[model samples]
Target chain A: MKDDYKDKLDSLPVDIKLRAADRLKIHLMRQKYGYFSRLCLLMALIGPGILVMIADNDAGGVMTYAQTGSIFGIGFFIPFMIVMLPVAYIVQEMTVRLGAVTHRGHAEMIWKRYGKFWGAFSLIDLIIANVLTLITEFIGITIGMRVFGVPPLISSISAVLIIASIQLFLRYFAWEWISLSIAAFNLVFVPLVFFVPHLHWGAVARSFGTWHIKGGVSSLFIYVVLANLGTTIAPWMLFFQQSSVVDKGLTVKDIRDGQFDTFIGSVFMVIVAIAIILITAGTVYGLTQTPNLDIQTILSAISSKMGPLAMRLFALGLVEAGLIAAIAISASTSWAMGEAFGWPKSINMPPIEGWKFYLPGVISLLIAGGIVLIPNAPLGFLNLTVQVVATIFMPAAMMFLLLLLNDKEIMGEHINKHWQNISAFTIVGFLIIMNFMYGLTVVFPHILG
Target chain B: MIKYIDIIGFNGKRCDMKNNKKTSKDINLDEDWEDFIKEEGLIDYNKIPVQKAEIKGWVQIAFWFLRIYILVMIIMVIIGFSRIK
Candidate 1:
């Protein structure tokens, strides 16, 4: 039987062969019937979901949460973060099902199932948003490394090399496992929350009921709300997860495991988000109520209140968040380009074999990494642009996802149930309203004043 | 018709067969071929061109909504950036 499997695998194309070998393990695991066996099967099947969710909490997300805590404290955003878990899961779960059913990435589906115009639109938007987001990630990386006396040039170049190498050298399974290993560092913020001086668990618990915005519904509050929402469900996440599911070779059989993985990842993402909120809320909230507080100010506040060790841990978490997100974002870029152009796309493909597949991702990484090192670069403007681009692109991406998920021909039996559609659409509707409000604030600046 | 043979070997490299003899074994007569394909979820999706979906019902509405939403947002952004300038 082993020899037969080997011979069969040997006959597959290079890219598919690696995926086949991984799926073959899953097939064998499925034949067994036991509690432990089921657990093992789930462990084998879980990657894309957890990776996507955790990677969603990228460096920008870290800064967003920290600033939320600094500006508003845990009064409202903590409970708000709790609401986001389900939002993240509902939006992301559709990708798992869509990928499993269609075996296509989001870009390919939009391109083929819609038309070139929409496809190009989505592709261009995704690529632009991804590049801009990558710059923020690199900014986070360089800034965090500065806490440890590393120069921006060294940190930025090293980050690009590390991310590019991970994408270039590792196959899908190793890539995911390695990325998950790095993602585990995102939880470093959770443990540091306990070290925050004068953090009141009682006040944190009371936040669920109070849900109070410190300054009322001001422009800053709306901006923060939209920023949190943007971080929770960006357009890249949709493309990332679907492409990840397709690349990981998950089928409908693995959907249950994928959902569980996504749920677990969401739980962690929210937990870490709340932890950052708490850490800063406890340490930096009263110290600084400035809406435009930079991460350096927040970190200095943390260091002042929580001691150097805790602040260092927060910085380490920032670096890890940036690194892991860079990996996922770059891979999503590569995958989307490959899917749209009909190029052979898989991380399992060898470097020489998938050069075309890897080029776009590497180029995006280089552009972002290089941009961050330039002196006097308008990173603030770029960050705002990332938000604006995501704001515009997110609804369009969600509509495509909802459309693809509802489509009967491709989705077949896996087409979204009625409840799923209601939940997804409601989420999309809520996102659009918030985005519109955010846009209004951007334009008027005094609309909420 | 020109016959082309594409063989994937154990090293996971593909070989083009212009002058190579076509062999019956290359057809994958093994019973596990079906199982392998099924288990691997190996559909050559690129070969299957997906038709542009018929946009009549709610999908059309969603697209129209998206168009308006994008237009409005772009205008707002333009105004916002102009204010900044």
Candidate 2:
């Protein structure tokens, strides 16, 4: 029998034989336990962080950067994005520690560790934010598809189907890699920036030195800056990454790698965001200043000046950004709700184990997908509200994060140092001041500027 | 194939420090480890063992408000925006 097996194996293609041998070796090694064996385990366990960061640059984010590029043309915000690197890392790093330590979603951690009122509050906030965020993702999908001459109805339905299919069918490992693949496309903007004609590298560098805004602080510029911040750090990110850290089974040991994952995602996110800004700031800024610069107008402008090919690629980036974020946001909503209520929560679990967790996301995606079909759903206003609402809640979220990260009992050796505390406090102070200034500026524009 | 790098890697963008095994080790350390180890004891200010289930009322409420404020803002913003243009 052994010789017969060998004969059959020998007859197989070399590639097939090598692949089979590799798998067998890995399986055998995994069966022999130790630190080295963990590579297999690690492979099985790497998704949620990348998803959270990529999803941070959602369809709305894509459009925002698209508009930023068209309007600002990439001077200071390019360097501004460098600060964003640590900003995103600092903020998300807490969620990694929180999840590994507490084994709870942000909502559940607040509710159970804190109490019912805050717990209920977090859940309500997370759900609304998640739902509204999903709406923006669908808007990206519908608009991106429209560029291909696909109708909104067709585009939204297809997007919903694709999103639901990924969520419902795959177990955790399969689900994560597939999502990461989509996220990889978010980098298209980086390359797309190079395609802009007569791109002014000198001027781009000069803007960083000058740190010039096309005009000084106006309501529009403040709104734009605030909206950019909103897209960078949405409320959904808090819920998404924490729930993700839990779902991915990141314990204190895994927290190191998880933080690494989030740091990586943050870097990519800032780069892609800046690229979109650079491309637009280079191309679009000073050329036009229309509040109505949705994906189509921006792409049309790029297409007219660049070419249809470059415009098509930009559309592709928009689609991937929307799709990846929708997947993450939907999963986040499902996971946060699941963890908070003490229902089963994991993509790895069969639906029988976690039906409640799975269903809300699916249902939410459908509603969002359906919303695109509504006549004049006021997408522009919806997008803006998503931004302003997110900024208002920023302080409250940061407060909870600071309090938790500072809690020596919970965080153990991971507690914020003096510098980290200073950074966090400074950011919190800055955010609070900004939020207050935003409200004040709204009330009396001439006062600050 | 002993291709661990291939299996778990990211795009090779210059800014992409994800798979740089050495640097990845040092990411997201929010504190000075040695100092934190020396300083943070396993007890709270009132000198009680910090148990998970027994998290105090005030601490819990602080967290709950952190979360609830998002939803409240959502409702407020929707209302506020609805009133405007």
Candidate 3:
């Protein structure tokens, strides 16, 4: 646009500009990672994968882990989550490849490769599930805000506006950094574990060696387990990662770096989950020897054991986690819908160019935020709906991801190898079992919630 | 046993995407940097375009079997829970 700059730009050798870009990238990475560090490779490639996995353990997820620890303690779930790190990583790895190679999102791939029927189904399911998920996020924020004595009305409205402002202004990279900063607050639960008096290191160690459930697979145990699984590997993750990969302009070359990002996110997720469990298990379950406790029980334990300050911190962490995940998941919803319908889609695009891409996420945040204000909506019921919908939807979502990944037409030689297949199938089988057990737990609590 | 497929086993490094046959122009990539992207660990990128001759129907079938296996496992769990109640 400027004649003088245009001449300068033309005068610069093409290789010089390319080298400048690469050097600038290296310099920035050095600033972030320190000099002579190679692991900065991941730092450069760490967007979609890390974001998806962290967002998976949203506000609802932290609550579930806390409730599980308060009710059942960390006799089993801690080690189980360590095992699940790979499970979450395995399922998510497919998206990195699919996004990089296909240059498309999950919804677009489905519509093109599978058919319209399944594509339409995935689009609708993604939107509804994401909206419901956002509602749960609002639930988390409102409940957590109550700890700070903030009125629910102001908290929900303020939360909605903050999320909208971030979405409206920041480009993808800046938005991602801001969201990642909020996600880092999820670490507050880790320190709370230390505040718990006389935590038995022996019991925590035993959980890994034995993986025991305290009360021998009761309905509550199964329900908690299902809730945990649903929270960890929800359908939104697939939509989020694939769409993010496409949006990030990740080519096939970025796949490994992407997987590394995913691996880091998974480790962070597990650690945060274990922290909540440790904090609650050390305080509530150990103190009361209670069975079948709920989220309120855990929150009260935090308040009683760690004081109002710690409790407020926990609630603040929940609000931030939920708010950040809501942003990511809501974006996932719009992207998936746009991909399915062949609408222009990208966080990088102007709102006008991609209004449809912006629509679903905005509407979801607004509606969910409003629902949070609706004089005590049947929120417990809504949480259950989130779990049930995710359970029903997960297999179909995984099925398509697995099929597409293994497809030579789409993935070329990137198809699942023997060991990878074994690992993935095992996870899928385990998830299905977990979901079925959860359904039964809800139906016959005495037998399994 | 169905998990033992080699379809995705091979890890890849960088490949020439500019000449990749499967690469499409529909993608609005940064045209100038088409050759600059580099993945450190992802193997699939090394293979570039999946060679059609490499299509493994057996692997696809194996993946399908695993899917049904999960469904069957869920059905069994439901039955077990129902009977227990």
In the order shown, the candidates' DockQ scores are 0.19, 0.07, 0.04
How would the candidate models be sorted by DockQ, starting from the highest? Answer: 1, 2, 3
lDDT of 2 at B31: 39
Question: For residues A225-277, what per-residue lDDT tens digits would candidate 3 score against the true structure?
Answer: 78788878889899888888776656675678888888988898888888888
For model 3, the stretches where C-alpha displacement exceeds 4 angstroms are A1-41, A286-294, A441-449, B1-85
How high is the CA lDDT of each candidate model?
A: 0.87, 0.70, 0.71
Which tens-of-lDDT digit does each residue in A1-449 have in candidate 1?
Answer: 45666677778777777787777656655655556556767887888888988998999999999999988987999999999999999999999999988889999999998999999999999999999999999999999999999999999999999999899888787789999999999999988987888888999999999999898998888889999999999999999999999988998888998899889989999999999999988888877767778999988988998899888889999999999999999999999999999999999888888899999999999999999988999999999899889989999999999999889888999999999989998999999888888888887777789
2 against 3, candidate with superior lDDT = 3
Worst 10 contiguous positions by lDDT, candidate 3 chain A: A15-24
Candidate 1 off by > 4 Å: B1-30
**Model 1: DockQ vs. true structure:** 0.19
> Candidate 1 at A315: error in angstroms?
0.6
After best superposition, candidate 2 residue A189: deviation in angstroms?
1.2
> How many clashing residue pairs appear in each of the predictions shown?
0, 16, 19
Candidate 3 differs from the real structure by a C-alpha RMSD in angstroms, to one decimal, of: 9.9
The clash number for model 2 is: 16
Please give, for residues A85-168, the per-residue lDDT of candidate 2 as tens digits: 888888888888887776667877666655677567667767777777789888888778778899988888889999888887
TM-score for candidate 1, residues paired by index: 0.94
RMSD of 2: 10.0
Q: Which stretches of model 2 miss by more than 4 angstroms?
A: A1-45, A446-449, B1-83
